[model samples]
Target: MIRDSYDVIVVGGGPGGAVSAWFAARGGASVLLLEKDRDIGIPVRCAEAIGQGGLQGILEPDPHFIAHEINSLRFIAPDGTRIDIQQTDEVGYMLNRRIFDQELGRKAASAGAQIITHAYVSGLIKNSDSIRGVKVRFPAAEKEIRAKIVIGADGVESRVGRWAGLRTFYAPKDLESCYQVVLGGITVDKNLISLYFGNEVAPGGYAWVFPKGDDIANVGIGVSAAMIDGINAKKHLDQFIERHFPKASILACVSGGVPSAKPFKKIHGSGIMLVGDAAAHASPLTGGGISNAIAAGRLAGEIAAKCIADGSWNEKDLSVYTRMWDKRWGDNQRRLYRLKETVFKLSDDVFNKAAAVLVSIPTEERSIKKIIATTLKNNPKILLELARTFF
Candidate 1:
């Protein structure tokens, strides 16, 4: 049942929304978390990989949610040359997102937040220029749930941000159309994750093979939407699987849009705020957003509760979220955006040459920082640009 009012109402029950509700309720606010899907984590859309350090900081590591532990990553060139780098400092894990998301929601409910699944938010309730609440449609009834603060953690196709007057549209070049399938009966290196790069394999993006275990993996490809002339993501993925894992059995399939753009200039207006993909907070280069989403949601929730306590629920009061986010990840995202644009312009031959160069380096010295520096060595101007932005 929907409450008559709440101190905060968060839309979408992904990591961002769940964590936001968790923090908000922990801060003594009456929080309501809404999920359009009947289940919290059904229909996983992500590759479900997270750095060990980042995941540990968000929540205690649980064996129940971990599908595989990855200690190395291999990058393959168009010509089949591969550079393997062991994770001496940055290990990661493949997660069962379905279980992981539901656990997050459970934690939020334990913190005193109420969760309502299958509640579709149809629109924002506007009180003049400010967003007062959300209008939700349930299977049995429709209700307008009012709140002092409304957070839009509602993924890439979020209408809440648009309804609140935020510019949330992304350019075609700044979006990635992705498709993936869970494959069984295939033998992959259980301790290593693989990424393949080439126009033929995945135009303007990359294909990844994240091992779920010894016999199963999530193999997927992300193609730059603007570069997909007339082909679709699934066709590319199908061709890739046929060539790489011909004997693998397909178990499940998923497709979604990944935001490859920089975060919006404004994330808050009046009493409303945007987080996660709603604010386009994914990394421009890697298209990874899980770590950033959790962090953003937690920070936004804390700020929201504090604003309500202080009785200051205006744009000025909520602008702290923007500043905090920028200081934490937004600035880094801007730098990555520049690097992404520059790297995507490289020819296939250049990528092969870069891979060859990386392969020549000693395994111990093949840190990502060093590899990137060496790759751009011939382009002094681009190297200088990187130095100015990163250093």
Candidate 2:
């Protein structure tokens, strides 16, 4: 029998929802996590890369979900100049999202959170000015589930946020339409992730090749919709693959949109809150969201539990979530967004020059910090912006 009421109802079962449900249940709140898909993390859409030590405080590392460990990065310029940088102190990982998501959902279940997959949330349950719960549709029936608070961990095209009257829409320039393919039978550096930049390659975005193992990698391209110029993301990605890995065999294909804008000013209102992509918490520069989503989900869950315990469900009470997120990541995201805007405006000539400058740097000083410093030496304005963003 499904309970009609819960302390918190979390919509969507990605990293954000799973983490939110786990933390909320762990905090003693009666939680319900709903996933529209029959299986969590199906049809992996991400590039599957995360920074080293990103999930240390959030989720414990599970070998079952780690596909590859990366220790270096290579940036390829428009003119085919490759600049390699090794992570001497920090590393990253390529995750099997299908396994990682299911494991996260399992963790949430273990924490006393009830999960229901294939249950699509069709509408919100409202009481006066505050959100009360959600209307879910099952294969055989449609039902209502009530909650003290509702958390939307839905993706870029989130309806939950819009239903709650939040500005979840992103401008074309602030959205990245991405296309990716898993390629096998190709030779690639198993320990290094590569990024390719140029208008012809990705127009306002970048292309990436993240290794999964020996001879296998997830190759993808993200193109800003505003800069697509009549072409689609797949077209750009196809051109890149043909030019570089012409012999690689395609294994799987995925496409999706990512929000590349700054976070909304408000992620919470009354008894509702938005986390992850719904909140636009992704990194504008790199289009990375997994780590930030997990972090935001955990914080939202903890705060939701507190609200339940204190019997405070008003917007003002929930505003703490927004404040905390801004303090933790908002500034960094804003800085990165500024950098992205500036970098996207650079011409192919500028990119070629930057790559040339980077190649001139000694191998010992080829760190990202030094590369940026050397490349932007000719552009005092951008260099100043970079300094302010980092320092």
Candidate 3:
């Protein structure tokens, strides 16, 4: 039963939206979660890889969504030299987003949120300076859904943030135009995640091969939009596929843009809050967003619900989420954004040399930290920057 209004309205049914709705409902708010897609996680985006510790405070990795457990990863340089890393702890997970996203939506519903698919939110229903609801185009009819707080968890092309007048623009250098394909019927190291780097491979970004099973992998590429003349992530990805998995069958493919930048100066307005990619929370260097999105989503949900309880869903109340995010991931991402500006511009030869340096380390002694220490030992400042970027 749809209601005229709710305590919180979460736009977009990605990880961020699900969690936001979940926490808000748990906090006793009437929550509504809307997904524009016909189904949750149908058109899978991203390479679908997340670090082991990435979900620490979120939720346990459910077997329903675990596609593969990664214990090792390989880095391929421009010259074709490979640097394989054996993680001492749990490395990461290759997610079956179809299942992952569905389960997240299920959790939100289980926590008392109302979930609706194919609900396309066209614009915000604003009341003076603050947002009061949304104008949505449902399959059957148009509707005006209201809420005390509206969370914009919509991805890169977030209309919610723009509608709220938040700064959502990104410089070309900070945007990664990405294209990914799931290749089947090919033999790959199922437990390993591979990264291919070189200008010839991905230009300003890198190509990734994340295994989903014994004979299938998500092969993809991300290139900086500024580094290229146009939106060419798909073209670069096509070339990489032809070279490496020529005989494999592409089961699925997707192309999109990922924004990576310092946390927005303002992610909240009078009655709206933006989380996930809407807030430019993806890693500036790697362009990964799952972990960061989940972290921010939780904060947004909790804070939004708190504001609803206090009867003050204003810009000031929502600013608590900003402060919390800044304390945790704000400084770190800002540092990475700075490093990305400097490192992502390095020449292919420099990347090759760095890869060689990493490969030179004995397998038993190899660690990402040691590799970074060895590669950037020449510059103490860069070394310090690298040391602080990981956590």
Candidate 4:
């Protein structure tokens, strides 16, 4: 009971938490942001490739946070056939996530939010059925801070929403177990991002190579957790690398999970709201989250501040956050998720046929969905089967 209260309390000082704190402070609310980690963004867990279109006007990325600019994509099928898609100037970036997270937290602080690291939130502080604040603990201390609104921007393992009784569980098929390795001594096109797709390559998901420079890159795979049956992801990744770039030197390795399901319908309840990965806002097709994280965070922060200003923290008031998120990104994600379902069900012949069609297309007309749909058109039965199963 330190007795320090704020207008809004944001848990987890990642991109979402920091952005929400920034917007909440900008909205004139006193805000507190807490991070369990000693630093705002350490222990990198992402593939770190963001689309240029995804990161348009929210905030211009600082130079310190951008590792490289990508201008094209190279899609490699299971048999090693490749389809190169030219990137629009408005698309693709390789980010330095640690610096990115720190800058976002700093921005939030500049907007008047108080930030504390190594301050793990242990539970929610509730007044009857409404979340009043959070109970937090640090290395040598513990306290409870009351607030008008509590935001759960904590990642996939979020406890804030769980404590507040929001359902955040993901079925095994809906979560991707990801492993990435930054490697040097590998020659990759500095202007091209690479993706590998095949059930054997990455069951239920895909593999990627995002070039950091001409000779270094981030190589990784996202596979369904449900598909991990005695085949360790790290082993598969190592084998792939050894087969493709045997002479490359490994720089670093990281592992984490990405949620690919539609966000929980009840991300906001009572006086609490969930955003970012906690709300499962990562895009389904790419498992790319930075853009959606910032989007959802800003929305939640704005809605929370408004609710506080109006002195109403009821579910109905908080529903604005849900509506805003749906209007902004929910439909796109749902459609992508459905598409992913069809993709994961595709067989080797189906994938090869799709690749053949992509190879047949003029370079200027090659696109992701187009290649797959065109190949399926040659076999209407297969297209109908996919559509029936998906739609």
- How large is the C-alpha RMSD of every model relative to the true structure? 1.7, 1.6, 2.3, 1.8
lDDT of 1 by residue, 1-391 (tens): 5579999999999998999999999998999999999999988999999888667556888888888789998999999999988888887988999999999999999999999999999999987879899999999989999998999999988899999999998888999999999999999888899999998999889999999998989999999989997888999999999999999899999999899997799998889888898989888999988888898999999999899889888888998998888888877899888777766766788778778777888998888888877767855555665566565
Q: After best superposition, candidate 3 residue 40: deviation in angstroms?
A: 1.3
What TM-score, over all chains together, does every model reach? 0.96, 0.97, 0.95, 0.95
Candidate 1 residue spans exceeding 4 A from truth? 378-391
Highest-scoring model, lDDT:
2
Task: Give the Å shift of residue 340 in candidate 4.
Answer: 1.0
Residue 31 in candidate 3, Cα distance off native in Å: 0.5
Which whole-number lDDT from 0 to 100 does residue 332 have in model 1?
A: 88
Per-model lDDT = 0.89, 0.90, 0.87, 0.85
Ranking the candidates on lDDT from highest down gives 2, 1, 3, 4
| Candidate 4 off by > 4 Å | 1-3, 369-373
Tens-digit lDDT track for model 4 on 222-261?
A: 8888888877678779878988889999999998889989
Which model is ahead, 2 or 4, in terms of TM-score?
Answer: 2
Residue-level lDDT tens digits of model 2 in 1-391: 6898999999999999999999999999999999998998996889989886768776677789988789999998989999999888888988999999998899999999999999999999987899999999999999999999999998887899989998888999999999999999898888999999999899999999999998999999999999988889999999989998999999999999988898799999999999999899889999999988999999999999999999888999999999999999999999898888878777888778778777888777788778776767866655765666565
At residue 201, candidate 4 shows an lDDT of: 85
